[model samples]
Target: MAFNFFKKKDKDTSKKQDRYKELTVKEVIKATKDAIVIEFEKPDWEFTYTAGQFITLITDIEGESVRRAYSLCTSPLVDEYPAVSVKRVENGKMSNFLNDNTKAGDTFKVLEPMGKFTTEVDAEKKRHLIMFAGGSGITPMMGISKSILHAENDSIISLIYANRNLESVIFKKELDDLQDKFEGRMHIIHVLDDAPLNWQGESGLLNEEMLKKIFDRIPSWGHENTQYLMCGPEGMMKNVEQMLESLSIPKDNVYKESFVQGTIDKAQKETTEGSGQDYEVTVLFDDEEHVFTVPADKSILETALDKDIDLPFSCQSGLCTACRGKLLSGTMHLDEDEGLSDSEREEGYVLTCVGHPTSPGVKIQIG
Candidate 1:
């Protein structure tokens, strides 16, 4: 069986079968001019989640169903209600619709929380977490910071967040409150692209020089006791990765969450090069076997959804591993494999959303 990380150990097995839930919006608070935080009422059934997981919100707009995934900003170990912060993006249908129309009494259909960018909390462990966030990417980091601080007495967090300007900083007051409450345990450094005249914080692109200065200010926990995390625009993350490499930071100690699919170009390969023909793929999920023909033009998950065969999926761009399945037989070509770690790829784990059958008799098993 596929490993089920989202399942509650004490809950009945029947409840684990549910893939979606209807959650009533308890409140909506304006986090910034372009962002709003939506809080959901606790359901009668048990709804549990890890700190860094995200929920896919589904709604109808202009007679068309739309879905978008947003990371939960409320921690299961700290907060009373689960919340997600949505920031408006250019030409983002779901984001704009929610920001403009969603209210406290509205109810939404949401997929259960799912993600891999999480850490297991241990009270006995003493560690330091260094996080870099840009714009709305701070959502998951907020939950993670709260969880770590509340659960581990000796663990500390250092956050370096960047935004367009002071007015656009999401969760400003909330972050200040956390800093004040945790005092020496939590440290935050804010960087802005456009700063006011009297601004005392950083105001520039996060270049190598800026990172060096920032590193000098933060606590110097040895690499063995420190873990680095980043979530933000592709450009910023690339820059940070380059700087970390220059600083001799090991790649294994750094992790990142991508909200958008990367645009880095890869060498082109023929879609049917291996198979030399259209292929029929078999997917075993939910105790049923689904057989379908997948054309070179469409992904496996896209074909399944077209046939009303609902296999699990979110962020079809392949940044989220919600449609991951273990390949039991045959070969597949992936347009993007950023969601899967190197070990997972070696273990035959494939993401159906960006996967195309590249050989005959392809078989996959999904939970």
Candidate 2:
């Protein structure tokens, strides 16, 4: 299953008049050797987003419509312009395209921000936020960190960031400046895989021993006042989770965000136990109902897109819940349901990106 990113939150989008907007690129700042931060000019209408939400960028690449979601690294509470940091991934079409060709004055269609990797901010609350980030996973954490530090004066943040090397770390200078400005409230520990000759900080794999040493250097708040957040590569996150479990931290206190989809089980997608035949599915969205026949081999979102039914979606690998909808009737089988919470699953919520109709009279309501 894909790593579940955040807790599900209720959001109604069907009533909104404008679902997508054309945002002009205001500036592009080179954040690292292989990463660039794209800042967009605020639209005339209200475009508010929480700290950890992601925006879907739509553009035509090689004559085909390509859409990719990038988390907003800028904090709505502190930053002047809304921006997203894009780190180039090897063989990643969208990331490479944006870094190589995107410039100021260019315009692209962007979907409104949507995500659940966020928490409510309370100025009076004094708590601790422990974050573990690696590689590009630091994007969402950057916004969350900035928002917490600016909004909650008494809340403290302890970030354990891991990277390939010193030069590969994103937001190095920005993090240092925040640490300096926040002083005691914000602390950062950097761990590098390949350290320089005279490196003073921790260097090597973030194993159990390394984590113990790092934890000793940071302040520890009791379970009642502490929360944990993590975003990073799959292996790194798995290690972190194991370490946290060994420490006897409650599972309820930990949350994570994942952009990469997990390995898919082909057998699960081949057929559902009950319904192996094609069936008609109904999708209600934007005050319109679409009725279409779905092939057994195609996913709901894929079939809908092939029929020119413009549906809201990003991260089609089932990691992002952008195509989430309520299953009004009938049964559906999901190739992956990691994006959903236990409560959401019990409430009949489904992700169209990985859903397949397993029974007739299927109706889904999308917001």
Candidate 3:
């Protein structure tokens, strides 16, 4: 019933102009102590997202609004209803609301799934995947790892998970079950920052020495053809990247997803006093157009959002391509060129999250 209503409304609005969808909770499962898996019945939901893409979950609070993006933990083609596993953070407004207030049959708006952190499994190429996960950052990696293991039986996956203690590990039972199901194809090693007083497993951070020890047990440590995925705290990723560099691993073979949030307001404030120049932005939406003035320091996304035009976005950190759009005209300066491919940028596609107009007039197709 909820799916039908949302689908009707979405189609009607989308036919008239641009519109977004709100997925309603069909069921909720207590996955772990801090994690809740909320399943939404999107029968009409077009599951077009890539495996590791994330959706921004939005809810209304006192007529104000709150939202936080969570990566989907299930594969796109899974028969299960569309769902995402959320971890509640202490003192976090959205997390607390999701953990405590959200229940089965509740409805909430969700932005379209977007993110560049995805896996492309090549069947012909013998692929070996290495993933490093920490805390809740394991969400996307879980999706990719599970999909690869299930879809391509020949693919090898090695996952290194770090948590404070055994109790803190999410999907502990499920992963263990999968290991038993698929013997040698999948490997998972859990590292604890502080072990239980009686714990006997690996007791230490996922540092160079620990990784080396684990790699010795499994020889595919620095395979040239392997793809490396690093997702976790900024410091952890940096440390891992440094370690990989020391091993002479190719940089392009390595992919990273930072579970870091950007301070958009702080970025805006820092650029406020720049006396920066102005640029004209031509926004093309629904066969109509609007002209907006953007400060040289402000990104095109910020300019559009400030004008109440809902442009797509997730991590405004220029990592996710949620705000990606084709440039119908003109050029722009990008802060971090992480998500944009060379061809995409050459063809004039830009990530508006961190893109500032470099020229006087820039025309773009806005969602």
Candidate 4:
């Protein structure tokens, strides 16, 4: 949740991060009807990764270069080779292709792991982990639950996994195995909107009442210090956060991450009328400089990519710092700044994905 497991480093790593490498696929296991588990051959060279972080997969979609990030579903402690889960979506071009067309022996340019939705394992103190997942959001939660169980000596996990029905649930067999292995330590509650008749588990969408009932039945383990971690569609995440607030849980112990920008409303795009002036933007990336003109209404990353300039970025929703860079000159405004730390902004760093030029001649240094 709010904890981390980073070791002391001799030097700064951010400047050396965000590199990409090609890895061969080892195998593909069908986790469910709509989801597939992709396993990669562990690289001979060093490429260590955390459990809940995601890697950007670069591919060609109908002659167009495209990049999409998928969370690593396999636990680093449990699996030898890194693996990720992909669920087919109706219009998700990359997801459908990966789930249906990709196979063993295939190769992909996978960027190094990057993300902040993580917690450390502490064997000294008992840990209580509470997780909420909806649909495909179960991918990261699976890794987190397994990592904690495998690495920590004193910890218990409680999972509230929601899906349309039994058939749509991903990782059913794997989760069942974990439950069997952990026994009383692992408690899983399934919430299905549609199910067979006489199903004993909870049914219907998850609400405040349903969550309370599930928690009431959960085993006791340091309730005052429990950690709540969540990832899902925007609306479900909001409801869970509200419920946590009502319970008077400390905000510091709660954590969340969204793969897409679901919280932003349609009205947010319709900003108040401004001067409507075009601004001059200069971006520096990969030791190269590109100068262009971007409308004040458009984001710097959008304008740069439109002009055929490649800049490192993932999760355009501003939840990841991949597109982060130093502001060299001029002024810009960010629609959202959750990923960027206060000290980072104070040091003139910005997430160009959501940063728009507020004045002319803005200079950005994208390392």
The local distance difference test score of model 4 is 0.81
- In order, the Cα lDDT scores of the candidates are 0.88, 0.88, 0.75, 0.81
Report the lDDT tens digits of candidate 2 across residue range 186-218. 899999999999999999998778888888887
Worst 10 residues of 4 by lDDT: 1-10
Which ten residues in a row are the worst by lDDT in model 2?
A: 1-10
Deviation (Å) of 223 in candidate 4: 5.8
Candidate 4 matches the true fold with a TM-score of 0.88
lDDT of 4 by residue, 183-253 (tens): 87788899998978988999987887787787788766554769998887777788889888987878777
Return the clash pairs for model 3, or none: none
Model 1 regions more than 4 Å off: 1-17, 264-266, 269-276
lDDT measured at residue 367 in model 3 versus the true structure, 0 to 100:
55
The reply for model 2, stretches above 4 Å from the true place, is: 1-17, 271-275
Tens-digit lDDT track of model 1 for 202-251: 99987767877898888978999999999998888987898889889988
Per-residue error at 305 for model 2, in Å? 0.6
lDDT of 1 at 74: 87
